[model samples]
Target: MASGLFALLDDIAAIAKVAAASVDDIGTMAVSSLDDTAAAAAKAAGVLVDDAAVAPRYVVGFSADREIPIVAKIARGSLKNKLLFLLPGALTLSYLLPVVITPLLMAGGAFLCFEGAEKLWEKLTPQDESADEDAAMDPATRERTMVSGAIRTDMILSAEIMAIALGTVEQEPIAEQAGALLVVALGITALVYGAVALIVKADDFGVFLARKRNGAVAALGRGLVIGMPTFLILLGWVGLLAMLWVGGHIIIDGLAKFGIGLPSDLLHAATEGVAGAGSLVAWLVEAGSAGLFGIAVGGIIAAALHAIPRKGH
Candidate 1:
């Protein structure tokens, strides 16, 4: 009876040891997987900044009362786009047809460039005030139109974000890949819309602050009230350039993947050849190259698109 009890104790001890080893292995893997996800998420930082920059303009021209709601509507749509559409599509493509992903990313990027260029064209050629249909829209219709447009833009940027994440994690086990993409998708959406909400509401915050009892606080608020518009204008320009830069970057990457690597090679060479320049210079060179490329492609697309409506008319 004592011998039997000893044998059972030994068996239990062996099982415990095995279980401990298994847990340790899983812990190591989980840490490594998280590290990879963080690295992958970093890759999407460019598009993420562009996403945030692109968002605030949609709330422009709306009444103060409607601004938050407009932002909310767009945020919901962006989340939906990421959680429902882009995430699953990214995973599916990774499994079945990974090769097509780059071109699709490029296509979306081209659309972004077109959007940026068209906006620039609008800036250059002011519209007739009396003939502005969208401006003539009722408040509700205008909100819907703006929200819809914002959501559409979010879709592409979100796709880029997910695709970038997918590229980094495609070699991992399916579960880890899914987990990383999921974390990125949720994290980025929360970050972007949260910042946008703060931005759109910053003026109100400023007004509130300006109305405070403390003189210093009030002065700070007044500063924000005065500074917000200039900041917004600056943001608009950033969004525009971001569209081109991101779009151009995506197109160059796609082209390289397809064996048409000249643009990518030249871009690399140019960035590397800058002698004695700091990291900032190299970054600017890359950005400028991508922006120029985007402008060229976007210009062609914008011309065709603008011409089509006139011909139809």
Candidate 2:
């Protein structure tokens, strides 16, 4: 009877060891998978940052209370763009028409170039637009317009980010690809909109602080309120720069995939040449060269667009 009991205990111990080993294996696999997914996500950082930087513009005219709610709605729409629409579409494209990815990426790049060029043009050709127009609109109407515009912009950036992420994913099981994409999409959207919420509310926080009796705190709050507009403008410019850099990089990479690798090659050589100078210097040189190339390409395209005649009988 004692021997029987000992045998049973040994059997239970063996089972426990097996379970522990299985759990460890799963943990190891998950860690490896997460590392790969993170690298892919990092590759799409330019688009992600641009998305976060651009979203605040859409909430410009809203009341303080409306800012967060509007951002939440836009964030929801962005998620829908990624999950309900883009995920299935991307998967189908990956499986059915793998060749289309390069073309699609190039198209998105062209779009980014066009948008950046348009913003540059708008800046160069200033118009005195009336704030009263926004002031006159009902809150609901304004909110709708802002949400629509934001979603449209988000669709473009989201497409680029999704494509980049999809491209980086290995030819793993479809489930793994899906898992990586979902992680990237949710992570990016949360990051962008969460930052947007903080940015939009920052001035209000400043105002609250300014009401405090402490002189230094009130002064700091005053500075914050005063600086917010400039900071937003700076953010807009940074977004444009990101668009240009990301757009140019995508086009260069796409062209290389299609066997036109000269541009990227030249950029790479330039980057390498600057490497001996210092890390920061090398990076700036590379980025500046890329940005200049992007600007030139964008300008040429913009010029060609202007030269084309509009259709009107």
What would the per-residue lDDT of candidate 2 be over residues 124-182, giving only the tens digit for each residue? 79777866676778889989988988998898898888887777553545565576577
lDDT of 1 by residue, 1-313 (tens): 1122223323322232223234245455544555444433333555666677778888978878888888889889988998899988888988898777777778877887888788778777968777678887998888888899999888888887777667665665566557666666666676678778888899989999999999999999999999988887776676677678878888898899889999999999989987369888997898789889999999999888767756547
Which stretches of model 1 miss by more than 4 angstroms?
A: 1-43, 61-65, 132-138, 307-311
Candidate 1 lDDT for residue 299 = 95
- Candidate-wise lDDT, in order: 0.74, 0.74
In candidate 2, position 193 carries an lDDT of 85
Deviating ranges (above 4 Å) for candidate 2: 1-43, 128-136, 311-313
Q: TM-score per candidate, in order? A: 0.80, 0.84
